[model samples]
Target: MGHTPADANRDALRAANLRRLLNPASIAFIGGRSIAGAVQRCRDFGFTGDIYLVNPTHAEIDGVRCHASIAGLPSAPDAVFVAVPAVQTVSVVRDLAARGAGGAIAYASGFSEMGGDGTALQATLLETAGEMAVLGPNCYGLLNGLNGSALWPVAHGAARVDEGVAVITQSGNLAYNLSMSSRTVPFAYLVSVGNQAMIDVAQLIDAFLDNRKVRAIGVHLEGLTNVHAFSAAAARALAKGVPIVALKSGVSKLGAQLALSHTSSLAGSDALYDALFKRLGVIRVKDPVSLVETLKFLSLAGVPKNGKLAALATSGGDAGLVADLAETHGIEFPPVTSQGRAALQQVLPAYANIANPLDFTTTPWGNPDAMRVCCDALLSDDPGAAIMILDYPKESTGEHPDCDIAAHAFADSARRYGVTGAIISVFPDLTPPDHAAQMAAVGVAPLQGLSEGIAAIGAAMWYGATRSRILEADSLSALPVLQAGQGTGSSCLYDEWDSKRMLAEYGLTVPASELVPPADAPAAAQRLGFPVCVKVVSEQLPHKTEAGAVALKLDSPQAVAQAVERMTQSVAQYAPEVKVKRILVERMASAPILELIVGVKREDDFGLALVLGSGGVLVELIRDTATLLLPVREEDVRAALLGLKLGPLLTGYRGGRHADLDAVARNIMAIAKFAQAHADRLMELDVNPLLVLEHDAVAVDALIRLDA
Candidate 1:
């Protein structure tokens, strides 16, 4: 799904046809135990849709009329919940497709999850079932609370809600765990996109984006089937004001392997996903609890207008806890205005510390009107959001009025000032379940755990600010689409001289250089001038410096000639197989204020990606890099460069070594354009030690590997 001609149209149609699978007028079941469980689930959830069971031998199942086959059904079902054996599931689904059945959930696990043979079987299942949106051949199926149409095949502890966050997960158990979380997450719908045989997470997200009933989306992912489609859907979700919070599990090495074996999904590098999430304005959570709690808070409190939040803590310990956690999560608590400080001083006790997380301890604890006045005075400054930390007294256990004043005061202040409000408990268990419902009743989220609450609030504010940025910004359709490979197998490696030559053709700054045989090294160096660098150029040696094939600061022709001979001998000792055929001679480059690494490679999952980071030997150790998909703007390049920890050094470390960022940006954009244009042929391009001087940037060393 590259920015190619027909991809957008194809994706548009695919997204348009994805909604029919979620809502079904009538559903048919094709197995026994699963059918019974589904029936029980439907009864519990109050689904009124017609349910028809199918089995050749049974005239009735669970005391409901059963069908002998697809033909015996009263009419075409909008969705089919198929739980037959693995081999026969595809045939039955194809038959349903022929009969114009709306959609299906194939809950059999023998498909791609098993390995190569299973992958082939799943492929055949998809090829045979044309235009019929089948959820999976290995899935737990869909749960819909919005319409009370439950095709789920297990007992779930979920309350029917007309509006809540829609959760989609690659793992069915994760989806179930989220639905049954004691955190009291408001769940409108939950979908398990196992193997994504027909309906992937991207399409589900796209469908959910248009359903205004879905307030937000919480996604649990192993890996994405389509990054391009997901990017398009994410941008739409942001623009439509629906925040998406994702917990990605397949980021580590072991987790990636497990994901591939589980669903035949390719786990691209985690850095790329980070960059993608940032570009699409998504908040990536670390674990499942974070995912659930964040969704719960967002559903009740709503996204704040910005990331600036004013907090309330009763004691010095609680205030310090808020400050530490908020700083760690990038949540800003800007200093209150002088007016706000004056107002707080008048409301608080004489000894209270009047700060952002103001400690107005027990001053107005039981006084709702006085607390509202404190809140109203603070609201006059219009900080993005507000939260109050309070642990309900242990004596109020099992009672409805437990901490009623605390909860009501928090909720009313938000309502009175039109700001989102939340109540936090230092420990998750301290926030009893009975009071959770009570807190929700007054429109304030009952947050649990100090660190967890702060992190969730930070994520909520990040989404709020990101959404506002998108709604006020330009269309993101111009952002690049990464397509699959097209180059032939003949593409191969180009040595340093040739690589630089090709880059120079694209207007990138490369040192003046020329390639010559070992015998001509002296003449080439003399022609280039004194103080030149000489390198034994070979396709076999990718890291020439590590291989002892490069020599720098050769002050004279004799020095250059001697260095070439020494490099050849060193290469022989390091690797006798490497052929030292020629040498590269060029005038030595003046050192820059900072050196950066710029690279481009085709990732298996995400097509063309440009990687920019701190260069040199520490690149792998530090790993301070940002990956961007191709066809990016110059502004994106500039932002990526300035985002590095080494960025301050380039901007003049202690106001002494300032390099021209505009020049660095210009070179980066040039290389990016070159990579994008040759994306099909270029397998990888590494420009290490890209010199960022006071006035210009230059590629000091390069290596190019073509696609094969």
Candidate 2:
């Protein structure tokens, strides 16, 4: 009842109109028994709408009056469910559009979902629909079970969905299977968006976010064609506090190829998606069940402020496994402090572990009070979140009158302290427990294994951290503007001098040096200092060391003259086409503490990016590096620093003092800002051997590239 298309983007808004038609006053079936098999299923599911069958071949079928055409209908139907051959579906939709049908659910293939002539035909059909919305030429259609609206084919089963979560999948069959899965998740809406010829999923997200009845949105995305709109819509959902849990399928290269073949969509890079998720606060899940369950957790209890975990399990082995996994995923397991331990000692037996991830040793099964005591202690200790481990009671074992009571005691203490609580219930087999649904109703997840429970908790904690980062993203630095002819476009053409100027302009310290022609090298060396280095300066010379264009530790007039003559000859022979600009003469640099390589490149999809790795030619072979998106925060920069394989070496290892991390971060930040600001014109930038000397750092070599 909430569909409107007065806006110019009416085709996009048709999904909104389709939502209302999900439960219409009446449904017009144009193909009779072609889809009449679904009549009993629809009526059984409590569809009050009139089923009008229109086919000249049948007078009546399934005890319903048959009409020869939509023009012969007694009154306008809210939606038309059409199932015919690929060729006939178009004509039916065109006629339906002319008849002013609310929307058309085309259960036919051979349109845009296929290539060649079919795509052209689909385009023609979309134009014919005009203001009306078409669900699919190749899709299974949508289910607004909230109001008993089912425009799908009879082949798909019907499930009871009322006041449940809405799922949007790019694949039709997957959406049906996800809804039918025995995961105990009730759904309110399920949309299968194939090809997205008329409307995309991003608009659907926006539509759902507008509906307050929707508790959350689950997206099964194969690709994102319109990134800007998706980001904008996603930001709105996050602001409105409607979390979106997405299970993006195509991340690997092979997966990307498969996705392209499946829907004719482009699957971008994994890194780009990672950056997008971090910025948008989208909770990404590995599988469908996890997607449903995680959204359920967010919907019911909400996320904690911090992810401080206090784990308690009946088995020591289970406790250990949880702790190890939590630690790996960055969930803090702060040990019970002295004060916390003393408080817990008041109520626990002597054998209780007392510390975080406390092992109850199976003795708590006898003493029901002990469970409450441990829960109270942990909650009162004020850990950000906590979980309890229990084995599901079997029917053969009979009902434990005290088990439910004990579970309630633990749950009550958890809620009392305003702490986030979760439970891990392990079942031995596929046998569903009688109380499984009840356990879930109380914020407990019935996990099949301890590993699964740990994984869920880890995901929750990570989501909390990533969301906080997204909300706090107010400090991205402004991008720098790169001038024309900035990048020479040749990998061999080292822009060392220009790059040094760039860094110095950005407030980095640089040693004194001047570019001198080969004829004036002797005088240039004397002017700079007696001890200096002579290096060839040519756009074509990438590695001066390999080409013999570099001669170090020169101390006399004869050495300077000889080095210049030899370099001039070497560069002339090797780089014959490159114009000989000047010979760079600089003072001999002092002893170094560390050397680093700072590189930047404009990725095709994600824009500017930075790479920090080991210095020298070994950088290619050593492969010690860390990559991050541009405009990083101080905390993010420090984290990147710590992530490097050579991180310990920078922390004053082996009597070496700390190598000025603030300065290094500033340098990296400068490159990132430069790349971001000059993305349109800049191609690449590299500062190899950025020497971290005793008290300062200097860019020894620089390279920059341009697009045009």
Q: In TM-score terms, which candidate is top?
A: 1
Candidate 1 lDDT by residue in tens digits, 1-708: 448656566445435435656777787888874476677677678778887788887887767777888977888788888888888998998888777777888888989989778888999898766767788768887888877777777778777887888998888888777667788777888888888977888889888878888988988888888888888888788778788999988888999998888877777688888878877888999998788778888888888877787787767899888998899878878777887777777778888777777676777766767676666656556667788887766763543253566567667778777777788989888787877887776668899888888888898888876666555666466443566476675769987888888888887898877788998989988888878898888888878887898888898888987898899999999989987888888888788788799999787667788899998776988888888877677776787888888888877888777898888888888888778778777888989989888888889888888876
Considering only N, C-alpha and C atoms within 3 Å, which residue pairs clash in candidate 2? 22-149, 480-677, 487-705, 487-706, 493-539
Q: Superposing all C-alpha atoms, what RMSD in Å does each candidate have to the true structure?
A: 2.9, 5.2
Which one is best on lDDT? 1
Candidate 1 regions with alpha-carbon error over 4 angstroms: 1-18, 337-339, 395-402, 467-475, 517-520, 571-581
lDDT of 2 by residue, 1-708 (tens): 345555557754566466545447777777757656556556766678777778889887767668988898887777777878778888888888778777777777787657898888888888787767676667777776666667677544445654556788888888778757655555667888787776677777877886776777888888876755676777777667677788898888899988888877778766666656655667788876677667655554456668788787767777887888787767888787776677567666687777788875655555557667767766676776777776656556754554664566567777788777766655424315544456556655444445555566666666677666655664312211112233445533335676677767765555678888877877888888868888887666767777788888898768988998887787778777756668888777776666788887665545555777777666878788766555456566667677777777677888878787777777767766666666666677888887766566777777777676
Question: Clash totals for all models, in order?
Answer: 0, 5
Error of 1 at 192 (Å): 0.8
- Each prediction's TM-score versus the true structure: 0.93, 0.82
**C-alpha RMSD between model 1 and the true structure:** 2.9
